[model samples]
Target: MKREMEDVVIVGAGIAGLATAVALKRVGVRALVLERSQGIRTTGAALTLFPNAWLALDALGVSHKLTRSYDPLVKGSVTNINTGDVQQVLFSEQAIRPVHRKALLEALAEELPTDTIRFSSKLAAIESQEQGGGASIAVVHLEDGTAIKSKVLIGCDGVHSVVARWLGLAEPVHSGRSAVRSLAVFPQGHRLKHEIQMFVDQQGKRAAFIPLNDREFYWFLTCKEENMTGEPEQIQREVLEKYAEFPSIYLDVVRHADLSTISWAPLMYRHPWRIIFGNLNKGNITVAGDAMHPMTPELG
Candidate 1:
């Protein structure tokens, strides 16, 4: 199907895509956002957005509504899951609060005009054309058989992005590690403080819990050299069994975790050097966020 030409075509409706679209709109640039999924993907996890993230959101006029103070960062605890050794670590007293993934997405979307996003429009392919007069154009193909041509194209399609692949970026390098994450809610309410807690076994098995509020906490477990994969229930079971030997406090977190929210994925990243020298864009097309730089969550 033929669609109207757009000024900018942004692939993916995640934070990066929506933020880009909103920012472009500030300068009288209209963007068409195409999301592969039927709706926004909410993983039921909380994210501690740093200062830079907030600053950018503010620039796009989205921060005022999302600017509510959350629990401040104080001391974080790291434990030796095997030897029972605990180390208390001090964190920056910054306002880096853990916000829910759904809330963050909704806040960003709210600032955008209604119908700015088109769902189930997964990118199929991209073709670059050398338009004369020093102007370039991109023809974007969607899985749904709709083709759109735009003067500029932005790739926020995330890791394993079709746009990134079309750009001939390097292959993803697996770290040979797998991670599982979930949120645990205490209906009776937890009495824990606002600090973050982490435990690591000698073999690189690690688990962490960050309190979102007094009644709920977010948690994740990581194991090295694992190729575990299956249904959601199987993934949750693997997470439970991997940290089965940890102290009751940790096991309790896993026990109380919402099984539906539990998820597992092997760690993978593009080599940093490749990212530094990688061909990010061709013609009028470029990428942002994971499509540009995807690092481990630990580095953040």
Candidate 2:
């Protein structure tokens, strides 16, 4: 079969892949992004972008677009359910905003050229070939029976990245904990302060509420990994039951959560030592983002 040729090929169109493509485009380097899904995967309800993250976004030229929509949170309070003690924490002068995943994806994708992202393109296997003169090329094969040759192959594919595995990276190990996240929509406006609120029990199970906007907010709960399977409704109920002693506001958030936004999964991470000593790249192939270093989400 005839093989197509390109300068750079990026696998996975998640936050990392899209951002890398935009960064390359700014430097006059065009990259083709391959996504296994049909469209942008906006499964994670939202993310808290710190000052450093915003600086990177600013470098990419998309921070203003997001800043206009989401306001920065400057303070938060953590409550201990076991002791009924609340502690207040203040943030520095830098901006900290929590944005919806969909909006963030769209913002980064907007900076790309037309057809820059190829959806429904799943990476099957990869091989490196010598092109003489001590040069090499990466041959990427897709599940659909198409082959593409590129000067550089970057894997931004998430935790289960095939490229990382091809490079002999160890599999991600479970972190002995599970998390459930979702967005709660308040149609008439939530009327809540623009601050983060968290509650923790004696068992170290924690729940947090973060306001995304006046009409919607993002919330998540982390606990010991148990039988957290089944439908969104079931998961929502589980959260309610598990944290029944939490503040009523938390319960309300879970009760009014958008079912489609609910996501439950066991946290996984690649050992840091392995990443420090393992083969992250070979020839012109390399990995980035979660494909390179995946860790449990503990930023709070």
lDDT of 2 at 188: 94
RMSD vs true structure, all candidates: 1.8, 1.2
Q: Write the per-residue lDDT of candidate 1 for residues 10-93, one digit (tens) a residue.
A: 999988898888888888888999999999887636676677877787788866665563566677889996787889988666
Q: Tell me model 1's lDDT, rounded to 2 decimals.
A: 0.81
Whole-model lDDT values for every prediction: 0.81, 0.92
How do the residues 143-177 of candidate 2 rate in per-residue lDDT, one tens digit apiece? 99989999999999999999999999999899988
lDDT over C-alpha atoms for residue 51 of model 1: 74
Q: What is the lDDT of residue 44 in candidate 2?
A: 78
CA deviation > 4 Å runs, candidate 2: none
Number of clashing pairs per prediction, in order = 0, 0
Candidate 2: residue 125 Cα off by (Å):
0.8
CA RMSD (A), model 2:
1.2
Candidate whose lDDT is highest: 2
Candidate 1 clashes: the total is 0
